[model samples]
Target: MTLASSLLSAISGLRHAFFTREGGVSQGIYESLNAGIGSQDDPVHVAENRRRMAEAMGVAPADFLSLYQIHSPDAVIADRPWDTATRPRADAIVTRTPGLAIGVTAADCGPVLFADPRARVIGAAHAGWKGALTGVLEKTLDAMETLGSKRPDIAVAIGPLIRQRSYEVGAEFVTRFTETNPSYAGFFVPSERDGHAMFDLGGFIRMRLEHAGVETIDDTGIDTYSDERFFSYRRSVHRKEPDFGRHVHALVLEAD
Candidate 1:
């Protein structure tokens, strides 16, 4: 329910939401507001949850769309809604089409929503460590440019994800980032555990967007790992739960 000043100021006409795991019918591990179509939650419950999300965005249920999300750098353009069963395998989606809400699913991973109201273009990306390191955010901006969006005009909001203090990683994970660019090394800090580091996922993402020339970037700064309102895969793993829920971050370009 949080709003980014940049996004709201720049794209006053767009409808967007960074949903938490708090208002759906799924029970137990999937407990409430689990919008992930790929999750093991009941199909009926998932459908109803998605319906609520779409309704909140002021779009029809059929117009709310999300991808299969393989955590790769791949990005696709969505001009129309696709059946859930056949959703494309991609980590990002960009669209200039109105009345269609484009979204990405995430638990601990970064869910970023983008918009350039001047160009009437909007984009959503699922940025896990793999996707972020591999350039999913940059690719999303490039795709928006292709749709006539100026980089400076774009306002991006990085939704809730695991914050640095809660995101511990192995030494190899630190090496993977440093190996790409030594400058990325700064994003990691020493953890309590030996040979481990805590990476600032949100900070790294903000740098990427800034380097790509996006002038307005808003980070929700909510840590999914600690926030009970949001679902987190790492939290679920640590708790030894069977499955975790997923949150949906969506952006819709309303019809004129």
Candidate 2:
């Protein structure tokens, strides 16, 4: 199944989907629609799955783009498609190019889709805690602005990810956040385990976007860890699985 944001849906000339782990040819743990190019899944299977995704977005497979995603705060502007072997090493992608589907891959980390219909610019970011804290969201907005997108006019949608109730963090993790800004502590609450707390990743991502001057925001409120329909890194780890699949959340500006 594919999920979408109504706020983004209401806009014309935009196409996107927060694709779940469904409707593809991948097998085993990647059991369908796994778009992670870096995964251990068979390369042919991955390509076929991505082809289906590209078809769903009404773009050729070559026009569907994603990054290597090193969890950095970097955001790059995409004007043309690049080979998967040469995918840019960045966490976010912004583009004004129509018919080019730009996306980010994620399991438990947040996948944020952004669009400014007025400027016809769109962006996708992989917001793991580190990336979000280090400024990926702000960087994405900056890149969009370069393409004539106004921060206030950009509408953002936060996709499914590990929610607070299912995301437990160690003391060191909490310390890292609080040390960044004492107010960040508000995003965590005590967990049953001592020296650990549940982190609200979705809330933090939304807060970062809001601070970056984006006013129209929506969250899918789907938790990957607890939801079987989605793939999840944490859940895979907890289950002692070797690896997890990734979902591709993409956005495209349709051509006339």
Candidate 3:
């Protein structure tokens, strides 16, 4: 498990974890600790994996919540656990409800956990390039605000994701960002491959948070693409593997 020091020091009375792929029953490509309910991994294996994650967070397995992420900027408020069959199609989730844990899944994509202890509000977002560029982070902060969380008081931790060194983008990708905001050019640097550039996803995500008025932001700085202990969608694709595992980053507001 990886935790952000800033989040730990600033936000009290919350439980969170950026679970690695080292503690579950699944084997082979899914390996162990794969918590993605959407993957083709056997439901039993996924269930057991999620149960382990929930136990680690000190929440009941039934109270651990995740969404059917579609790489959209949509955010939903989770007042209670939803059935797996009805998972909302959202990239972020915010809640003030204690005892319920909200989480987002990511392989190479960014998984961010947010907490405003004073307000007892917490959020989790799945931010890939699309979601981040489309305002998922901002929407997440906005959702948290609706539940009484102050942006300045909210501490966010950027969990494991593909770092810039491992993330390469084509010319069109660069154009998409630059066209959105020419200043975004700073986030890209020329890669060895012609017409391609390396993207600083972690830095971009942090910048978005800062621009959104968040004062305490922590980035784990772990690269999923390079670390075998974590899952990476790109890595799976490069190897032509059938499927990829998903890591769970969750935050819970402890019951008073």
Clashes of each: 1, 0, 0
Query: How well is each residue in 1-256 modelled by candidate 1, as lDDT tens digits?
Result: 3334455545667888888887789999998989877778998999999999999889999899999999999999999889888999999999999999999999999999999978999999999999999999999999999999999998899999999999999999999999999999999999999999999999999999999999988888899999898999999999998888998889898898
Tell me how far candidate 1 lies from the true structure as C-alpha RMSD in angstroms. Answer: 1.3
- List pairs with backbone clashes in candidate 2: none
Taking the tens digit of each residue's C-alpha lDDT, what string does model 3 give over 115-152?
Answer: 88788888999999999999999999999999998999
Q: Which stretches in model 1 have alpha-carbon errors above 4 Å? A: 1-6
Q: lDDT: which candidate is best?
A: 2
User: C-alpha displacement of 172 in model 3, angstroms?
Assistant: 0.4
Q: How many residue pairs of model 2 clash at the backbone?
A: 0
Which candidate should be chosen as best, given TM-score against the real structure? 2
Tens digits of lDDT, candidate 2, 26-76: 898888889988889998999999999999999999999999999999999
How far in Å is the alpha carbon of 172 misplaced in model 1? 0.6
Pairs clashing within candidate 3: none
Q: Which ten residues in a row are the worst by lDDT in model 3?
A: 1-10
- Give the runs in model 3 whose Cα sits over 4 Å from its true position: 1-6
For every model shown, what is its TM-score relative to the native structure? 0.97, 0.99, 0.97
